[model samples]
Target: MTKDSVAAVLERLSRLYPKNIDLSLDRMFELLKKLGNPQDDLPPVIHIAGTNGKGSTLAFIRAFLEKSGKSAHVYTSPHLVKFNERIVIGGKQISDKQLLDCLLQVEDANDGAPLTFFEATTAAAFLAFSAYPADFVLLETGMGGRLDATNVVKKTVLTLIASLSMDHEDFLGHTLAQIAAEKAAIFKKGAVALSQKQLPEAQKVLETYANDRGVTLKSEGKDWKIFISKEGFYFNDTLFPHPALKGVHQYANAALAIAAVKELNSKWLANVTDSQIAAGLIDVVWPGRMQPLKDFPLPEGWELWADGGHNPGAAKALADFLPEWNDKPLHIVCGMLTTKDSENFLKQLAPFADSIHTVPVLNALHPGRSPADLAKIAESSGFRNIKIEDNISHALADLTAGRYAPGRILICGSLYLLGDFFSSNKGVKNDRQ
Candidate 1:
């Protein structure tokens, strides 16, 4: 957890670019070119972009492919614990030695010029991925898709866009169409593009983008689908267990992973049987989303959970799923970045909580929204019994000290907050269904 070579490099890169995001591919392209364009040398890639569910979708895809006896290299952003968490080689995270070498190479390649942390590290991931031998690679965009660091891959075998919603509005345009268009730009003309059922506004833009390129996107409820039945999860008519990840919202994401696997027809996955697909849905491991916190110190008889749901779309998903908790009194300890639409996000989660405590994300470079500021928004959003706490420990202490009754605790709002939480709590990984 301490600052290692990889962390040191990341720390320097943070100073090179503003802590705030500057979304574009220009810096990424330049850095990758200096690094010999390792992106092109990577194995057949399945690139994914979206406002939410990008990580979970990748997890399901990785599980399905691995279950089918395939090895894949995965690249995703905002690592919860370590920088090594971002790059996986043949199912294992890159070793510290390899990660440090990659970072050194990427840093030297930049030649002291400015580059954002994500862009520079993306180059390092591609470099490591290209050097490693693997059957496939799963690449997830860091932010918006079009100019994102991962979008440098011109012709992926499959491109996926998961749930889209209003997020990073300052960088991506404010409207849904604008965000959808940015995500659509990652689509390769010859690739089989698939998406979860999008809202009308977002779907229109996606369909228009597909039509303009003459590519028929296989969409949920149109080309393929999945649902939970009495038997279990059903894709078309096949009965499979529920997705390894929790929450009803994951059914669509699992289906999206299945759809992406379908495009693997040109590769080893083409011959994969339905049974393997069913097993994959039952054996995926995604650490942060709805992850139960155990083996950590907590109040007596109180269960804890953590989610990295930062935007309105993610907030709505948590809101929808909480009602099914079978009457557990939900107490949320929340923190969010300053850039997020706190008012809107709070509006969605406020209705589901019994008591809400606002806490500052102490370690974030961009800093969390002030607890007082967040409290005002929560109060206005009709959140019951709001209080401001200095940090997660303080919030938990308040609950433990009889400020609130024992209940189910949810630590949410930002991935950065969860990153800090996991460093100390180090919760057990979720069990595969």
Candidate 2:
């Protein structure tokens, strides 16, 4: 099959199966068995699972490994522009021909068993990684870690859990402990587990789980810690360069990646030079998490920032970074899926936003909170200046027309929303388009 044809076939397969995310490992395991267990053939794996910051952490790891002249394969989810963005081999995205070939191979192996879009794509990634020669493979969980398809991997050199927050409540659970427990399921026996600084309840839950499973638990601030200063950050006993990714919360995420690599201490690549770690931290880039789009349809000196933060914990982290605005009025363009906590998310915006503009995300799978409904939520959350626009373009137009300030424009809420925004701005039609 040709590259376009391969993509078309995968698209068709995605549409054929229901997109509703079923939280279970049975289907993926069965599918992998039929494919001759390709996942077991992957290189030294670094399995990262969390509600937020997982993608950034993976990016950091990839950047550092590449700096050290090591080849790394990465698999992430919910591509911003193209499906090919999800799979990378040897630090490069899979070519069209390679993607098509992998897809065809997986389709032929499936033998008529139904698989979700994510499941099929993951299978294709593992197949590609197994076929290729690389130094390491970084895997990020799609949803809840415990039952996530990526969890089937038996042995991981290291596992890092980033900030755990309340998200996907209907599928994962309602409370924080419940969500933490699900994420902690990624911990494998004898594998080193490095956890970011979590809440008291979540920390206790993860520690207990790791101990019970005989996994060595390295909780942030106890086993290791990151100290951020005006100059940079100190990881463990070493004072390393600051992270390339913006935001104060990123320091912790970068430290987690470094700790994971340090724990591995591969004899083949022993003694990771400080220069490699520094270069990796500086060069790493993860889109849609505080990504700045400098050249948008906005006036000069007007800034636009996009993030995929949707829950209360993510909002609080964003709020902590807001003080750097230096009193510049922030114009927020926000949209969210119906399953999210709209009220809680909006309330966190009160401190940073000068005015809130709400809009419906285009082509979202789940029902989205209408601009009007989100405006109501914003008002009730003590945000007095609230406006509802049909979509992002109109919202930006109105914000630019009004009395402006030397401030940034924040576009946030849902990852799907951010993907749509990027597609619209870049003139590329994605799955949603």
Candidate 3:
């Protein structure tokens, strides 16, 4: 159980930097130098970079490897409930004592130098992983890959790129090709790279980057592909178990993870069999991405679901899956960060939802779009019935009391918003979690 130690460290770290994202590797490299470069001492690492699906793909890789009897140290960013969720040591969340001690050590090593929150926490994770025994390290880039703090590692055995789209346009370039180029920077000269299926424009940019870097990239739809059926998923004619993730898009993400495991030339996985990969298909758990809420305080007649997909591509993916909910009324309680394209995101979901209730996300990192602002955005996107609520409890109360049949409810937008849901409704399983 985590205590005030975790909270106190996070508060101090956040105060070290004014802004959240300052994308560069110099600070991370300097800190690692002072700490004797723990990143170089870790086991073989699988670096993952993309706009979306990176986290789920990393989860699949961990599940696949762990099922094959390999221990892994996994790192991801933008925690849902607690900061501890970002760092997984030896297949478990770092203990409260372990996390706080590592953070304090890194903080002291910094000696009043400037480091972003992500950079500092990631250093702590690397240090912990280096000291511990693990066969692999699964690292996910926090944002755009080229200058992400996590990219400072000295050795990355394999790199995987998931689906890319226009996100973080302010930091990364505005165009899809530019964003693809930035993600491709995660590819090192001696490391192997595997990419998910990309749009033609994005694919062209990645191809150029690969050729320029003199690295060969094995991409989906070429080097490998998957055939999805109701029974299970087939990769290269060998069938694996069904993907436990909620969205149909998960089939594609699972295929990429499977491809990486199959393609990696590592002694650690030299004896891994197909049956382990099949078992791993049903083992991975990534919350807030099309996760269903089981025991939240809802009326007996209603069903609730939550997803933390915040970008236009994520919105498109959510729109594609929401249709399968079938026949029943689907109402959405949505909140979004001010940095997101709210109108375009709601434009995709507007056609499916019976009504949309806008709420402000309670996080201050990025002040969320006000409910009034979000309501107008929803209204412009062909949403006929739009309501603004101050908080999620009132939204749920009004929704339950309103004139509607037995139906499903979707709470979406930022992961911070979903974090609020998790905090308010504790002890509820976010399905497969």
**All models: lDDT?**
0.84, 0.83, 0.86
Ranked by TM-score, top first = 3, 1, 2
Q: What is the C-alpha lDDT profile of model 2 across 246-309, one tens digit per residue?
A: 7888898899988877776643353567788988887788887887777675776688888888
lDDT (0-100) at residue 370 of candidate 3? 94
TM-score of 1: 0.94
Model 3 TM-score, 2 decimals: 0.96
> What 10-residue stretch in candidate 3 is worst by lDDT?
263-272
Using all chains and alpha carbons, the TM-scores for the candidates as numbered come to: 0.94, 0.93, 0.96
How far residue 50's Cα lies from its native spot in candidate 3, in Å, is 0.3
Error of model 2, residue 263, in angstroms: 1.2
How well is each residue in 134-210 modelled by candidate 1, as lDDT tens digits? Answer: 88899999988889888998648888989999998888899999999999988887777899999999999999999
What's the true lDDT of residue 304 in model 1? 84
How would you encode candidate 3's per-residue C-alpha lDDT over 57-135 as one tens digit per residue? Answer: 9989888888888888999977888778888998988887888888988888998676788888999999889989988
RMSD of each: 2.7, 2.8, 2.2
Off by over 4 Å in 1: 1-4, 18-23, 266-269, 402-404, 426-433
User: Distance (Å) between predicted and true CA of 396, model 2?
Assistant: 1.6
Write the candidate numbers in order of decreasing lDDT: 3, 1, 2
